[model samples]
Target: MVSGQLFNHKLLDVVFENANYGTIIIDNNGKIQYISNKYCEFLEVDREDLIGGYIVDFIENTRLHLVVQTGKSEMGDLQFLRGSFVITNRIPIFDDKEIIGAIGTIIFRDLDDWKKMNSHIKDLLARNNLYTPEVDQANGARYSLHDLIGNSHEMNELKERVKRVAGGDISVLIRGESGTGKEIIAQSIHQLSTRSTKPFVSVNCGSIPEHLIESELFGYEEGAFTGAKKGGKVGKFRSADGGTIFLDEIGDMPLHMQVKLLRVLQEREYEPVGSLQPKKVNVRVIAATNRPLEKMIENREFREDLYYRINAIQLVSPPLRERTEDIPLLIQHFFEKAKARIGKRVNSIHNDVYELFKKYSWPGNIRELENVMDAGVHLSNEEFLDIDALPEYIKRDSENIRRDSEKIQKKTLKELVEETEKEEIERTLKNCKFDKNKAAEALGISNSTIYEKIKKYGITE
Candidate 1:
């Protein structure tokens, strides 16, 4: 720590070039006074070359220069460079209210480094919260639009909607029944977006405990609360910095957290626990829920303001039952996925399985089908998946569906109408002491016609 004028490049050349952390010192005008070796590596450039360049020339979206101008400090802030969020701090050096230079420190180079740091933090936080954070910080988007898989009209339209929404930088809310692949749609949107190169963090709002929800989403400072770690932990919003965050089962999020989430959505900034300053964030949110948010709002369980903020664009995942035409496609896809994943010789599926799948209502949607296929493949020693390989509950459902189908198939519309007519005529006759004229008037038909219908239906006195 020298207090002298050592901002010259050649003076600190050897020292800064070999620094372990990604550190940068910029003058009040945002000119690079010095850039450390680690930062040069993250920037994919030579330290000597970047020593005297402008900060904006290298970083896509940085606010360090602004920090120097405003003399305001920003710590634990996220900045996007290349294809990842680099957690950084920008502290302005001031001499009696006069700004001199700003020091910027970065956390990680890429997703791998971020994962290493995040995993450590999760380990520390898990013991206290009894929950582990999502590993979405390791990468962006696991599935693509192609993974949506279906040629039905509902699927076609939904896919098109995804493509359209992906091009924009706005909040998206995905609505669907449980197991209908809402998270898949969310991932698809992130995969197709411009931020696909960054992280895709997922959080199950309902799965998280109510008490820990605040710290989990917004992070906390050192000793912020009773169980707060030494250095505090970065939340999902920070990990997702410049990428996307998926909030699944959002309706289950507590009302207090909903207010905090609404603040982030509205302000694009969040104050971590025990910290007075609000760290700036630039993340796209894609929330999913099977529950009716509007109804929840009516019940005063959800915030109406937050609803509008997240509902900038909405997509409805088509229930599997509604698009039965895609059942065959989904079956083959999940079948191949399961077979490949299991690394087995389960190469074929019986025709009866396909028929049963097509006939079933699929109350649990695509996820249930995938799970069944996975279980079936796992249980199969034979080459083909047969009725015997299916679960007993599925077999029962299939049988009931087939029986209902047969019952409908056995009777024609005319036969059913005549049978109903015969029963009503007999009822009216019984009510009127079997008088033909009175029965005809009560039946709303001619006496001859009623007699003919009764004979046709095999009804006799």
Candidate 2:
């Protein structure tokens, strides 16, 4: 038994040292106990220097000690190491309800591996854009007006307004809740405009670091900073010269950057980082944000002049809840798309599915609906999508609605009939959670009729 245990320990040691990725193990006290040879090599340090030392002594910006203290795992966190980024997983070790130590694993062997992985991910996204309606063939915009699917009056009016302004070169401000297709509207306007042939550059102001936003938007000169690209880097504005630059989450832009953006809009020119000469560019701006800009302005978080500049032609993308009439159409579109992508044989969705969908306030709007449909298609094993395939949160929401509805008292015969009808529909939906068509068949009614009844009774799930 001792020999076997010794062999197992030896095997573990070999595995840790020879693993392609770097590994580090530290005790609960935050003292480094073990450092794999790979990790030592990656850090350019001798194991003897680190093994008995506190982790902070050698590693910069490390949270492994915090993980040990909090007894929580931090997974797939990107950290700057050496001169490049590395994806790491720091997991706390537990022993019989007590915190023991922690293990930190570097996902990439080197910076080259991280770069290769990033490139592959970008390629996959580009390929996906080809399949979805999110991209325009002629303009290279991520989405066009045709991708904006809806039949509600609000949607129709929004579409008409977009078409009217598509011919003009005025700055547009798109306002809406999160996931309300702000970016899609921006892309559509870009695609339909006269600058359709030119590049439609997009930048998320919130995503770029504060210090880097100016250089990223207006380009930079050679030696603009320590690591500025050689021969300078072309900013999004220059890249979209004579085209459109869609600035997403504009509300999150820093006040200083907002001032610079305002200047670009006013003069149609911008100075690159480390350059005194202002470069001219005929770039149309379409900014979108979920933030309440008026409130931001009141709070002094966003600039007032910049707000007015971008708000010259404002378009509001209505949230899914406000346009519940479009739920069925959006569902059908998403379902068909998801089915084709997943190679699912499913051809029909149950009316109860739509019933539940309509009843639920879609906080994430169309994006959330698409995600739910995609998930449903992948989860479904039958020929149709039903309540069983819906996400757990959706199901729980429906249950809450049903429970709340049960409290309503029926005083009249008409009310009693309505209550009975609602109860029956709810029960049927529950039993036939895997097949909405089967539920409709059991009720001796057409699928469309069931949908009408669900809408009338406000039956969910």
TM-score per model over all chains: 0.62, 0.60
Q: Which candidate is the best by TM-score?
A: 1
> lDDT score of model 2?
0.82
Q: List the candidate 1 regions with Cα displacement exceeding 4 Å.
A: 1-137, 410-461
* lDDT (tens digit, per residue) of candidate 1 on 1-461: 32447576566657655544578888877888888767776677887787668999977898999998888899997565654345788999887767888988887544345534433332234335432223333565566666687999999899778866774578999999999989878987776565767789999999988988888998999999887899999999999998899999999999989988998998899999899999999999999999999999999999999999999999999899899999999989998999899998886899999999988888899989999999888887757999888888999998898897788789999878866777788898889888888899987889898788777767677
lDDT of each: 0.81, 0.82
For model 2, the stretches where C-alpha displacement exceeds 4 angstroms are 1-138, 410-461
Clashing residue pairs found in predicted model 2: 134-142, 350-436
**lDDT (tens digit, per residue) of candidate 2 on 1-461:** 01234224346568886676788888788888778777877787887888769998888889999998898899998665652346789998787777777889887555345444433332234345633324345445766666788889999999878877776678899999999999888887766555665788889999999988998899899998999889999999998887899999999999988889988999999999999899998999999999999999999999998899999999999999999999999999999999888887886898899999999999889999999999999888767899999899999999998886775542577877887888888899889993668889998999998888888887766
